[model samples]
Target: MGALLFRLQQEPAWFVPLAVLGALHVAAVAFRILSHLVLLLRRPTDLCHRYGTWAVVTGPTSGMGRSVALDLARRGLNLVLVGRDPAKLQDISDTISCTYAVQTKTVVVDLALIATPQGDEALRLLRHAVAGLDVGVLVNNAGLAKPCAVYLHEADVEAWVRMISVNLWALTEVTAVVLPGMVERGRGAIVNIGSGTTLTIPSFPLFSIYAASKRYVTQLSRSLHVEYRGKGIDVQCQVPLFVETNMTLGATASRKRRSFLSRLIMPTSDEYARAAVCWIGHGPLCMPNLGHRLEWCICHVVPDWMLDELCLRLNLWHRVRFQRLRTMRASRTNVVNDGCLPCKQV
Candidate 1:
């Protein structure tokens, strides 16, 4: 034993570095494998031609919601499309019907003011959507991201109310309406399209209202996942960063707009939707982008004070970027203090 110890002590110190590198490589491969495995386990491919599983998609007329509908329809699940735009909803219905050869239903009820009582328009619409079918999936993807000014969301009161209704209240209501049936059936999946901004510390630049609403979603999904875990109900939140959507384009180019570190990170909608949909059937709380994941980790691991300082700089830098946009706007569109004019239409 003494001879062995002396020999080991004399071994080259370079082995430590080599061992660390080897360990790191192993960890990376392990993580990659695990990620794909989980994804495969949750992917909708398993349910192809699985007729009679009703999947209701909120905000199905646009953005992530539309993409999710396409994914589900491709797999042959009967779909009920929900959104405020009847014309747009009808267009989607026709296309999905012609392309996928699956049954499609439509509900044009606005969630902005859905009531609790029977005959209440919103509930009535949802009830009718799944009138005779068992809902196996629900996607709460409808929301609004409005422009703002100041350190927090001091936007017009009406705008805040609208955002709150669509982003938070409507989502909660839909989940509540469908949860009982899911619990009774003992098998269901719920997907909430939340925001990555809520997971970060600095809050939403000038549009804090939007992030605040989404924060409620993450909390609700986490709580429900715990409450309904054994009942066969799966709830999840999808947080994406800088997704390329009309919403993002409008919000990023608004009069009160700004840019920051997020400008360095741009994620495409197609990839985000695919990853988020893959996560829904597996578990809850799926964040797809790498930049968002890193920011979330730093927020958790670092001291609050340090994060606070960083957040402050990020806020100001974003504001400056917005100001630059204002400066670059057409001279005729310039407003007070060199701000760009409000967008002609959202």
Candidate 2:
């Protein structure tokens, strides 16, 4: 024992560096765990009164956006529900008004039309809709992914254009419009819905552009949080893994068609929205769901190369499935068209 103690007292040069690194790793892990615990325990801020009575949510017609809009209304905040479809927006607004007894307004705008006269008109409409209200919370929840995973070279030009316009440009423009009011008021919260792709895979092989866009969101939110923290505006980038939304499930499929495995892994849109709202003041960034949090930890520990390979394989499988479905739909359409041609001539 004395001999071992004597040897330990004269530790090797390599051992010291390794020991220091291990200590740092331990400390970082502990700090993260404690911080998360505190966040879990903290009560959510009364968002309606904290900022104002009005909150604006983009993409509120369906999925995570719809869930978030409803949840905000439930918390006593009146809603400015923004979306592309006027009917859907009105429906959501009516539902919120009926269920939560909160005042609701609908702003119909296609945010994908960036930099065009149409886009400007849409922004004008949005501004006009919220002009009189004390807009407090701005949820930049509108985003688009490529229709399916594909190599950059294989991606359609128009699809890439729309993706960039909606995912990045729209977020930027909407924030610019809403932020000044928040700054002037000296209190607000902005939740930018980012994707797990930014946090998990070191490089998303198939969904490269989408991942990059989300990374932009994550970084922008963090920087803005730092810039505006003292001003009482909390900017959070909430990164979610698969939530059972049309974006995750194919657009043509009903939510009822989601598989058990998918339901197990992916939170329902409402579930994700509730957790995201609960973590509002707790972040520059966060993965709100427990399943997603576990996935984030696993991604950090896994070898990058291994993750790359796994993502590639999974994306390839999705591509194959997408192609097969498309082909089947095309075949059915051809059959129907052939049957209708004679009737049209008559």
Candidate 3:
């Protein structure tokens, strides 16, 4: 410490300036970390009170969507559950209604059909479903992904079409359907579920379509937040890292290779949703889960080229694993068809 002080005194002009800049940088980083810590430990926002009473969730039958729906219901908000399947929607609706003393409404619509003639009908139905209701929150959680990672040209055109339709077209249409009401009421929150793959890395190689779709979501949320903040609306794009959703778990189902570290880093859908609900009506773009936030920090610190290469390799590995799982499932289906054993869906 004395030597540093002597050096600073000896070269005050350059040394002192550099030392001040370094200290300022360190302080900025420490403040950021401390703020994140506070967010992590803070009590959840009373969403029902902050926003209005009714909350709408898309793709509420599974994964983060289902979990987020349940979490919001637990917080005393009535739910409007939208999905493709009537049965699954009813199941989750019943579960929420019975479990949480909250009003539950289910609207069955295939969001993937958004650009079609049926989509117009679906949109009308969606509009009617939420019309005149004090719907204050919209969770555009419905999304689609390729069964496995593949190059754009090599991937099925139809698969890419459906993904874009659901991820982009559907989300936009649903938001349009809901936003006017919010604008009229002058209060609401829209939470769009985005993937961490788009933000943490510069390039996601094999899963280009999925990554590109989520990038659109993040950009939309930011623009909407800026546009609507004055009107008493909060638009947030909540990006999550590797959560143990059906998408990720299905890849590793046949292989018992998930170690402790993997589990530590990869939260389940329910776990991520718990943290996710706490951040609603807050940030424009955020990683809600603490583990994901840590990974986000590390990814930013890593060199861009290094992150790109690591992501490419990891996705390639995932591609291979997913293909193998599909093959196994096919084989099991054939055996079941042969009446060799009882059938179980993966």
Candidate 4:
């Protein structure tokens, strides 16, 4: 330390610029963190006033989508809930209508099949549903993931196709359906739910398709934000890490039981949704959960190779556990079948 200081004193001219550069970098980082804190501390914007009277949310029956839909309704915006199941959609719509003084409408569409004849008809229904209504917000929250992690070659082709259809095609088509009205009116907010896998790591091996599709979402959101900013449309992609939703419940269950970090990193769907609602129309890309944002900061410092290896191992661990559980369930079913009496004997 003394030798370094003596050398710096001897060459103060060269050292001063380096020192200044280091200080500036620190200041920039501090400013970014402080800005995020301010965003977290501030009040949520009034959706009904800032955007419009009606907000449309896809995949509104469960998980983050449901929570966001309810939060928007609580803020006095009428809701148009879109999901695959009519009963579940109606259940949530009824809840929103009963608890809040807001009107609710349910649109049943299986977004995964959006390319087929049935899907075209459903898309027509969706277009008809939002026509002439003042839709101020569009939440593209509907998405799909592989049931279990697997290598690219081992993955089922049909399952991957479905995931791509829902995560990419459906989101794009839905945005296309809603964005026209927002453009005509010159004011709107579009929120796309993105995964943290794409942002925090260089590569996600086993879940390649899912991560790749979300990367597309991030790019699409950013490009749209730039293209439509002049026209009064705010396009944002909210990147969340793991949340306790049905999609992740099985994958994360064993990990959470074994690792304290898993429990800490994964927030409940409602908890994440609450944070998500406050951040709409604020930025083009955001990590809504405070814990997730902290993790993201730490991830940036990690070398890409190290992050890539870590993600591979972690996903492999989940994949193995998932396979084991499936095998166990299958064995149990076989045992039950063997123990059952013959039909004629019964």
- Clashing residue pairs found in predicted model 1: none
Candidate 1 global lDDT: 0.72
Task: Look at candidate 1 and tell me the lDDT of residue 177.
Answer: 79
- The candidates, ranked best first by lDDT, are 4, 3, 2, 1
Model 2, range 1-346, lDDT digits (tens) per residue? Answer: 9998788779986987898898997677667667766776887778877888899999998999999998998899999888899889889988998899789888888989868999999898888888868888999999888755788998898998899999999999999888888888898889899988888888777788899898999999999999999999999999998887765644335657867655546878998888888887776898888667767776887899999899899888888887887787777777778885332211
Q: Which lDDT values do the candidates have, in the order given?
A: 0.72, 0.84, 0.88, 0.88
**Tens digits of lDDT, candidate 4, 1-346:** 9998888789858778988887986787677678778987888798878889999999999989999998998899999999999899999999999999999888999999898999999899999999999999999999988745798888888989999999999999999999999999999999999989888888988888999999999999999999998999999999999898766644455443546565457877887888899999988999888778778878877899999889889999989887987797777777668986332311
lDDT of 1 at 253: 51
Minimum summed lDDT over a 10-residue window in model 3 is located at: 247-256
Colliding pairs, model 2: none
Model 4: weakest 10-residue lDDT segment is: 337-346
lDDT, candidate 2, equals 0.84
- Residues 137-165 of candidate 1: C-alpha lDDT, one tens digit per residue: 88898888754434543456766777787
TM-score of each: 0.74, 0.88, 0.90, 0.88
TM-score, model 4 to reference: 0.88
What clash count does candidate 4 reach?
0
Q: Give Cα distance to truth, residue 343, candidate 2, Å.
A: 16
